[model samples]
Target: MAIPKRFEESFADITALATRFGENEAAYLSSKYQEAEVRQDFLDKFWLALGWDIYHQEHPNPYEREVKIEKSVMVGDRGKRADYAFYTAPNFLQARFMAEAKKPSRQLENQYDCFQAMRYGWNSNTPLAVLTDFEQFIVLDSRYKPTVERSLSGILEKFHYTEFGDEEAFRKLYYLFSRESVGNNSLEKYVEGLKKAKGKKTAKAAPAVQIQPVGDTFLSELDVHRENLARAFKRSNNELDGEELTEITQRTLDRLVFIRFLEDKLVEPSDIIDRLGKKSGSPWRDFANEIPRLNQVYNGIIFKPHAILDSPNFAPNNKTFDEVLAWLSHKNSAYDFNSIPIHILGSIYERFLGKTIIVSDKRAKVEEKPEVRKAGGVYYTPEYIVRYIVENTIGKLVEGKTPDEIAKMRFADIACGSGSFLLGIFDYLIKYHVDWYSGGARTLLSARLRSSA
Candidate 1:
């Protein structure tokens, strides 16, 4: 493949600038200015050379800027900012890449630099993060975790401007980055190829049995939708208080998740979101009208039998609904109801149930329940933990017994918050009975199980 003459020229100029700056100004940079100021100065020129309109001047249109410097995101109490975030389009909301810059004198290969960039990229759900100073550039795949043990050696690439003219090296950098490639997701494919080349070693290292939860990613995106939903509801109904806003958001999440799960399962009325997406007016009303039908289909998960769907439309307006739906429908959703383990939902909900969403001054947010905090924070018992207790207590009594032999098994939980343990026990009983009957001389265990059920 031929390198474009224009990009070649830009690279030449950038390499020349980098060489001169390294020789002349690298040593004095640390003494003259702080990290923030150096980052701004380098990014203003470096990003522009890479075909990014960092200042939004090339495209004067508000939504047409190739790059945006949005306000810092608050991870918790402290606010952290990405030095340069690049978007696939002029729309800033479609951010696809991130760049974190360090002072020219600071080592870009340190764990701190790599970890910080990785966190910001993962938080934004971007494919790649660039950690660079004027002298060196390191590209990190943000999908994977970075560890201090590896330093920056695990990154996708690390190179200096001294080799900018090497065709193979330049091609490697350009193919994986170059604005056009990153925007088209070719970069992601390239990174995935690298991971795949390692074969089963990598797969074995990160197996399904590892028990890593997607809860953080799910909760983060859920929180975003929750905030957006609350704001939209408040705008539509000013009389809503913080508590009301929280309740409505919680119900909305429940309804949406239930509908999405059923849709994925190909249950009846499987296209609720699809149908709702096609409509023009407020979607919540349509959903409300269908509540009775949904309740019948889903066994009353979304709506209870005599419950009233709040008037004035409990649904978000069109724009908000579209945005929220788009977020939920992203290609890499945290949890896929179809393939995810059933108990994983209960595990996630266990943590969720330990908290409540409250609006502080009309801004709905999640807060840990006071009792949960006093009891040493939200802790979800692992499925194995629940299984152990159930097997010992419930398992022994039911041994050597047929479904008909055992008329009924009684169990109780004094402190049942989310009923995850209870569900585990119920599942145990059912499985034990099914296995016992099937392994026995009975050829028609299906009928026996159905009768017991």
Candidate 2:
């Protein structure tokens, strides 16, 4: 159903859509409506979508039947099954038009439409006959008495705005069909707005959409984290100015999200941290151990940095900030700069993580690392997949980390196979740089990155 173009000014006042068969609707409704369980369900959805109810008087000729027009041109041909034939007086008005409803998959074409609808409408003395495949509804009307030609279908016809299979039909029907109705224009505009809103516009994720407070404690922590971040950036980047740095920090906090892969559990800081420390010993310990190993191999760098300024990337002023930012950018530009958030490691080794794969490889040729299991199986963790997981999980990852925190971020697969995780080592390294260079404002910086995504 192509949307009707209601006169913008009057659209609000009339609140009705302009209903046209061919110019607006790309397709028409089919008249053959028969009862088959599958067809009924399909038609039911179609009927409701088109604003016609079973209880209404102008309902299609039959409840459900796959009927062939008894006497018509296309006789002896197969007919489509439908739930109802509906007509409305106008837009949201009386049954001025009649239609036959069918399941969504039926395409309106040279089938039983002419044969069935002409006979049905001729017998009922109705002005319009319909053929519809829930997505696209067709409208067939009498040219003289018995002659209703093909109106809307295919291309080359000037009347192009016809959309019978979409939400646009309702908009048109209200405006065109009910010229006398009040607020016709308003309804049309409303429908248009609905369609527009429904359209895939660049919906800037509502300021990184703060989820409802699961608990005040987390909220408090989040707030403190953000505030501290703002202060840190303001303190470090005096060149960028206070307000600008503060703004960046706030944005970073907003983007902060804590995600957990576990099913049926509210993600909490303790989960990741606990798991990381629980080396088989403890999962958390295993993860912690894993991070350093990965860091050494992928980034050729180690953080286990206890001192705030121990890492050369840390900056307190202009000279240091420039160097830090440069290093950050350079590291990220590399093919394998796994950027792990600094605070994330200390907050909880469990979150903001880059994981290794534990699968068997097909060839089993390479020397298997500690975390990699090797045998006979297609178990190579592709870099793209690992990168996607870490980037996607960043939201939840930040929830557990804090500034001035750098613990060994690691991912250990108890059944490490082909070391699919090693592929993501670059991500872990880059995250480390990003978190440090962000000036403790992971939330805001993350937002800028996500918007580009």
Candidate 3:
């Protein structure tokens, strides 16, 4: 097949850029070249040639743009902005893939660079992402959860700047990432093909590696933390019964998780937990001291002082508290709470709430609560099911209602479990109200009033 005229032009431009870089490699690779310069001069043209509306020229509305620049996403406890996020038109809110750009001086193959890109993709539920510095372009498979230990894994393709001119290489790039191809669902199909091919190849050699979902993995870790905290508390306060121990342990874990979630959402400073983890004094005490202030600011039940748990006598050693903090830290943790949906957290909490700590002979062990066990264990309503139910019921009820009318209606779920149903309803109502406002509801109201007058 012949290369399209647009691609031919892009290839020529890229070749020229490569030649210029080659002539003064040191100068281009130096700090003076700058990331913004490379982005403007090379990357912009590279994507524009792929038929992307890089500047949203065709789509003038900010909300409807196919591409977003410097899109901020939560990664661990802080916000990490992706250099570019590409979307299929009309579904502009959900990104199809992310592209992270760095200066020519930076190596794209490093663990840090690769992991950063992968985390953004994984957290956002994006299947693939690109990491490049114009020096090297890498396509990464981001279906697997990212971890520091597996930072280098999941690299699908790598291309040097010189490869941009090669017909075969350029063709591959076009098929994989071009706006037309992506819009036609070619990228997803290609990823599926690769997975099937890999599965066949690995079938005879070894067992398939089971990739755990982020929510499940986090829930498992939460269980371990709960066990550790429960045992530590039991050892410290033998007078406390199993119920008291469980309440204290669960409350402490809940507060920590809540604060971490806030930090990732940019509502709290990133260092709030990290500073406590690194404190010379008791980390538990320092963390406890921060809760009162947090409660004052947020006025929430999570941070509110618990009569038993918040008492000075209700103390766990610094070591146990520090370990939990270390596990939740950005450097050590795999979770980006901001990207993980609230429903997933609710699901985790639902499961966590079903289990209780039992103390026997000074050892604490986690067991399913009797009610949960009788009910055959905790079950979370899938988000899809919840959404479907909400759409049919709450969605229909608020179809043309104003925000004030919708706000007056109350939603109830007697067996709420994790309150997933309520959350789905809340999400639907919020979107309905926002759409009503954004779609000139006020203009309609003004017209109606004028007609009456």
Candidate 4:
């Protein structure tokens, strides 16, 4: 295939920019040359050359733009901003990939920078992202859950500023990240090819190493929390029986996790749990007190006071409550609940249902239920299968139907385990309605309302 004239022009511009950076490396690396400066001078040009409408020159409408600058994504209680979010045209809402820019002085190879970039991508459910500092460009596989401990593991490719003029390097960059390539599904195909290659390599290895999914790892963490909390509650309140202990422990953890989710979704104030942790009084009590207000707003049974746990006699030590709250609300906590999908949360709950708490020798322990043990183990339906079932069944039912018509139709899953199928149905409906409203229907509705008035 021949290189297009536009690509050649872009290559010349990138080469000139690289030359400028090389000639004044020290000045560019200085504190005076900030991240914004590098982004405007180098990062912008880099993406622009790749055919991204960075400034929306061709697509003036905000919703039609292929790139979003400084898009704010919620991470736990805090909001993190991505420097650039590239998208395929017509799907301007969801980003295809993110680009994080740093000043030339900053090291892109550092764990902090790598983890930050991957975290944004993982949280947003984006599959790929780029981290650059004008001096170095790093491509990251964002499908993996990011952790500061293993920040470098997800990196796919790396290149230095000096390599910008190299034909091979530029071609690799263009093929992977150019807007034309992305629109043509080149990026997806590339990732799929990488996955197949990885699977083949792992299969041929002497001892196959299975890379655990984020959901399984998170479920393990939840099991640990349940065990710890169960033991702590039993130790603190000896009067409680096994059933009471189990209920209280599960309810407490469920409430805490839900609050964290709400915080990340921006439904609740940031760090509501953290603020509760800072209280001199019982943090659990403070949190429990806030539940009523939450229930008033959201009107759900999850926030409702439990019959036994809410009793005055069911008090666990303040120290125990404080520790759990601190573990969740601490700045360095590993879990980012926002990144986890609703189906994954449902899967976790399904597994949780298969376990029970047993009190022996004044100690509480989590154990598999008799039925679950008899059946071998708890089995969760894979996300892909659930999506397929939902689409084939519900998709057909809602075809060519208006939002009101779809709303009137009832969908049911007879053996709904943790409501995964129902969640899939809900997700399909939301997207369907949004697409409908965003299209011609919205204008028609407005006209109808105006005519009636």
Candidate 5:
């Protein structure tokens, strides 16, 4: 197959990348090529040159162009992982192809490498798979079952980075693995053609691999929760304006999640939300009454609520509140809030909470907050950005300090919306303090609290 006329731009980019790598070969081979992180970085640049969006921030709906890294696929009781999974569309219902990467020191054509790549492809049910280490790329036919006895002989084609300088070799690479070729089903077709040329009857392709689901994407679940709670709260209380209803709903979700987190962390007894579950009776009513007592017992220590029991939002008649409670409880979802990363939770809230409900003509309508939309539509400051800011400021200030000494330092964020920056700093301190004290710091911190008491 010939390279398309449109390949001119990509060809230039590939040439430039090859030249750059060739010039830095000595330093890279000695150090960077052996390190997993450094090799991953180079792979990102390599794909970027081939038109994949490595950062995933350029597109309006980043999922369309996103190259998901370290995508987990459960092989059995344990999870197996691939370095990159290329989805043709954003919903990730089907993976068009999969790519497994290795350190530059590893040979892409090695039997073990081929076996590993084939396993991921077969598990994912992708028709085409690529194994690469920035230096060598081997595209394989994953539709056939790959066996341990003969792994290296099952490949379609292999190419070296040095070969990109040869027009014929570059054309072969473009035909088998270019973004356009993969997107348009050309690569699958090429694999099929190779089988036909070898006088092999086209075996019916195996069923698409039922790859493990990504486990209820956090943002999708959060969005559904937000919409349902807003609707339920409004249905239960008709007198409140849209803004009031939104505030009440947001606060309710936040408080419940916060308590759930505490329970998971062992800071609170497990199953605090379970106290609300009932087979028959006014469970919501009972739950509402218990909040005041709870506030009296643990208010300032955990969180202080503003008369939650008195609000119509907490009324037992709002049976939908039971649904929300059940959703947050362990029986309804697999999420273990204790172990789930805090940044994932923070980012979801940051994005979903940027919209407010408006009551007009006695009907509620949800829209993005005007100021937030004007500023750029509720984009969560990516974790890397927050990391950079916090490391330079808070990290530098707190270094070489004790937990007690750190306690004396006061910090403020004037524009702490969903508190991603502040939350990051809090997480940082928690980790640093725990590391500093190792085994006994929690005991000490608890004692310090008791002394203050």
Candidate 6:
């Protein structure tokens, strides 16, 4: 049935509810309406303005009939009629939520009483409870769905009943209640779960690939193959010239080996010895020597075959070998300083490691592709990135120095590639420095400090 607009017993009525009583009853209610609860007054006015059919079971008559509220399923049984309940619109004459008004002076620490009143409407999806002392109103819900709010816009969600009438206060309350407003807020877990689900779904929508864990069997064979190749790669041409080569490490075998070289790459022998503090038979002996008996240790491991980009025709670039070595071992692991170019090291990693499979996206990308930038030659450092690093690491150190003086500090790069940013800083300083012993020395000094920093 089509319900009438709010407060209508039927559509033909457009009259004050207070008019239904006799002269004496009307007079008493009229007086009571003026001086009764200010909270009731404000709440009544506010909800009435929102087009609600407002009423009070405890009216002036003191003998009005009691009305029962619909109970919520989740609430099970703790449900009762509230002092007030406002229906959303006439069509939904069913109450959207209920409110229990307390005197402005009533001490109300336990919010469960207020929620119990609203739980009466749980049969319908939107079961809500609100308590007001006029000065403050608290809203509670069994409606698992959370509400969002922002300061710029009061209550980003539709419900702003409690926060209305005072826009500024409402705005602050809006942000105070966000599910993710605080770093350690309890609601953060729920929000994070949703985010992780979305991320997984997005990844699934992109592409996919197979990934079988490469075990020790695979790793051993690969390591043996790598050290064998490294031995050849490192030696002079004359050492390999006269010897009848076996090509025992075939392309197919190398490909299989390359795939796992990264996983089993040995750590520095020196570190193991350092930690053990010098031992005779401790697994440290194999690595503690001049050559670090890596070849024999890995050669003993046999690889069980599996497939993906595995075939006979693989000859790895020299750089890839070093990158894998660098990754498996630390930067300083190789005691020699003048070994090989950093770019070549990165290139080796790009070569043998193989492409990463975007399992969710259903695609595989070659390791040498996009994410890996060769040459280490950056075009420029973006201002925000530079400023952030400067602020955190160097800005405090160089705070008062003139730009000219700051430009000449010494630095070193752990993995410097053509030093583009260093070059950029040099260019910037040349424009500002008024006095310099020589431009080259100033530029070199500027580049040096940046590297170490």
List the global CA lDDT of all models. Answer: 0.62, 0.34, 0.78, 0.76, 0.64, 0.34
Residue lDDT tens for model 1, 1-33? 122235675476556656666676756356555
Candidate 5 least-lDDT 10 residues:
207-216
Worst 10-residue lDDT window for candidate 6 reads 147-156
Q: Give TM per candidate.
A: 0.49, 0.23, 0.82, 0.73, 0.45, 0.22
- Which has the better TM-score: candidate 3, or candidate 4? 3
Angstrom error of the Cα, residue 370, model 2: value is 99
State residue 13's C-alpha deviation in candidate 2, in Å.
Answer: 23
Q: Which portions of model 2 show Cα errors greater than 4 Å? A: 1-39, 49-51, 56-95, 102-107, 147-169, 174-453
Give lDDT for model 1: 0.62
Off by over 4 Å in 3: 1-28, 40-68, 71-79, 86-95, 179-188, 204-209, 277-280, 440-453
Per-candidate Cα RMSD to the true structure, in Å, reads: 20.1, 28.4, 4.6, 6.1, 17.1, 28.9
Candidate 4 per-residue lDDT, tens place, 256-339, comes to 888887876666756788888456466766776787888888788787878777765666667767777876773655455655
Error at 205, model 5, angstroms = 14
> Over the full model, what C-alpha lDDT does candidate 6 score relative to the true structure?
0.34
**How do the residues 32-133 of candidate 3 rate in per-residue lDDT, one tens digit apiece?**
787888888778777877878887777655656788887434545444567888888655545788888888987668887788788877766678889987
Show the colliding residue pairs in model 5.
125-209
lDDT by residue for model 6 over 299-387, one digit each (tens)?
43332232211222322334544344333332212121111222223333333333221211211112222344454322334433443
Clashes of each: 1, 110, 0, 0, 1, 23
Which prediction has the highest lDDT against the true structure? 3
* 10 residues in a row with least lDDT, candidate 2: 331-340
* lDDT preference between candidates 2 and 4, better one: 4
Which candidate model has the greater lDDT, 4 or 6? 4
